[model samples]
Target: MKSGGNLEAVLNAGEFAITGELGPPRGTSIEAVREKAAHLKGMVDAVNITDNQTAVVRMASWATSLIVIEEGLEPNYQMVCRDRNRLAMQADILGASALGIRNILCLSGDHQQFGDHPRSKGVFDIDSIQLVNMVKNMRDEGKFLGGDDIDGPPKLFIGAAANPFGEPFEWRVHRLAKKLAAGADFVQTQCIYNMKKFRQWIDEANDMGLTEKIHILAGVTPFKSIGMARYMKNNVPGMDVPEDMIKRLKGAGKGKVATEGIKIACEQIEEFKEMKGVAGVHLMAIEWEHRVPQIVEQAKMLPRPVITPGSGEA
Candidate 1:
């Protein structure tokens, strides 16, 4: 019953969990956040509030997470190591817990150079794996990183990011194992466009028995247009968009690419449902929140299952 959150309960109950992402607005637009969350309210088990994603500044993740909760959705609060020291990290964890944020995704955020602020100094005091261990200790030991006692430790279901498409392919599984050892209860991988490679990676995890130790939620994103597909294929690091997929998008003809993209995403979700090591799908409909329900329904993941607390059954 880790964290007693819907995500953990769904995974524990052996349901194919669905999670969505919500990027905070660049300014103080609470309405904007709520509007985006409204699109995903009942379509996903939990929503991940990205923390200064791509190193661009925005509303703080913890605050946005609270807003999502106010909208009647559980938040998977994301924390990146690029902007905060350990002290700030632990403080934010405590604050998020106090605010009822039960799920968190730990990450080594995109480097600052890639963002609007190229000159900003990064404070990568600790890597993502270390951050995972820190959170686990706080939850299980009720102690701070400095070994100090806490009046109340955060009971969070910790998560970390995985890049199964990263090069030196053999090391990907080992990296996941390291995160599991560091106490990541679950992981959401980089966007998976290369299903062949993803299947191989999951098979490796299954062979190592890593799947049983950690919940691996395969990441999926629909290509909104041909430009998006080409950009991800050539520009995005660790993204593997097969050429045939791009051709397929082109084959869809003008004015219909977006629809084709959604169809492809639905097909991917169907495949994920049958994948052995996959516990769920993390639908990262970047800025396309309004389309989430359509995709989920088309994938036949509609009417999400309900898991009663402490029962571990959907």
Candidate 2:
């Protein structure tokens, strides 16, 4: 298994780190995920396997991450505290480590009512911060909640999500600080559509010294149409696609709106590409994975110095 610290090493070796999210299928068939994995192979540093994303029933993240690993790609295994208690959460972390899934994204999942299954009860036995602490303990102390030593403690490159655009922005920053203090090695932010606000947040993070503490990957998603833009703005918590973007979508209309969105996303990426404290962009294309390579290429962020596996040492 690759060392869990490799992710931090890679991020530190360069000014930018690129990662993409892959939503696992809800069914038993592995064919769909396998196809997606094949397309993403060698194109990104890591592919995040979403865990019951949006509270919808889907393929468990651990299984999907294992599939990505078997496909010869780095898998960012997402672990959400909404569905599992401390026991299950710790067990799954160990299980993921055994499967060679080194990178983990800790999250407090979306409420069940927001998902397709409204009647399903939510199990937020552990919040996001506590989950981070759990993983930190498992990594540092090599013991579970009961203080019993396992065969071996899991080594995980822990990633936590942040929403700079969410409500009570002060609370957002405070929580991010808490997560980092709890041992999050890196942070992947929510979709950022407003460059001005994004810059402001980056400034704040830099002032708080997070810029030096952990790799911060700014999230960007391409809007397919005006409908999508509206839906995301209205529905997705911690996301806000501005009116100008929606106007752009309306002006571009059906055929080329996605291309327009791509341009916008690329522009956002380019704007942050050379910034001193910004680490890199985390592209979340949802089902539009095929467009990522083009976005990267068009942004002229390509031809980055390749740090082949073992070259990330300090």
Candidate 3:
């Protein structure tokens, strides 16, 4: 049952697990994959390999995940409904398992309008929630989507995305519950820039006892520059960036802005450590992977835990 790599190992051991994101290279060369994964090797419990993120074409998450494993890193393979139907999705579960992939993150994906291939046809054959349920069924019931028996089902740790800052805020927690109900083992929330709103959302989850049933890692990303902050605030849908945060980043000296960003990220990680219902922090530095070691070390999240067989088993 531990096929999802150390992600399940770390989570089951009840440690504050750290997860990172790695977008696959646009080309086929595996060297690009190794270079990006090198930054996160020991710093994170797992690395989420995005599936054609932002609708832009990239190396397949499944392929990249195998590369991560080759580099001795755990991959949380992301799957989007944009390109695959339920049939393809189910096939991937088996294929990925054969390739030694374990953890999987289900996503509805960014609309095609946002990617380079705007004219690409969208495949809404099944939404993310349904995908979660399907994968759960495959794992638990050992059956294919059409009820055919599987030879050997994939043993995966399921994950879903949540956005605390999205509008109709109070209901966001309920949405998270829906993912859990659909059989999500864990959840990684969207980047949380609005701490106040995230606290509110978390309070709702805690009140409902959802956090106790499933692991929830709050997403944290640092703003590298004034322009980045502005883009997230003004352009990113479902993101809420406060004026104070923008001001702090803008106030920093030109040469020190990146350091300031790291400082801010560390502060959020520190707060996440003490927050109720938060299992850990999901660090998404974007292309800023090099800063991950510094941020986690400064946040005192280094010296990652080691899980033995008896320690992490269900």
Ranking by lDDT: 1, 3, 2
Stretches of candidate 2 exceeding 4 Å from the true structure: 303-306
Q: Which stretches of candidate 1 lie over 4 Å from their true place?
A: none
If candidate 3 were superposed on the true structure by all CA atoms, what would the RMSD be?
1.1
Query: Candidate 3's residue-wise lDDT over 1-314, tens digit each?
Result: 44647888888878998999999998998998999889988999999999999999999999999989999889999999999898999999899988888899999999999999999999989999999999999999999889999998889999999999887887788889999999999999999888998998999999999999889999999888888989999999999999999889878978878889889989999999898899988999999888888888998998888787676876
Candidate 1, 119-229: lDDT as tens digits: 999999999999999999999999999999989989999999999989999999999999999999999999999999999999999999999989999999999999999
Query: What ordering of candidates by TM-score runs from best to worst?
Result: 1, 3, 2
Number of the top-ranking candidate, with lDDT as the measure:
1
Model-by-model lDDT, in order? Answer: 0.95, 0.82, 0.90
RMSD of each: 1.0, 1.9, 1.1
lDDT of 3 at 1: 45
lDDT of 3 at 45: 91
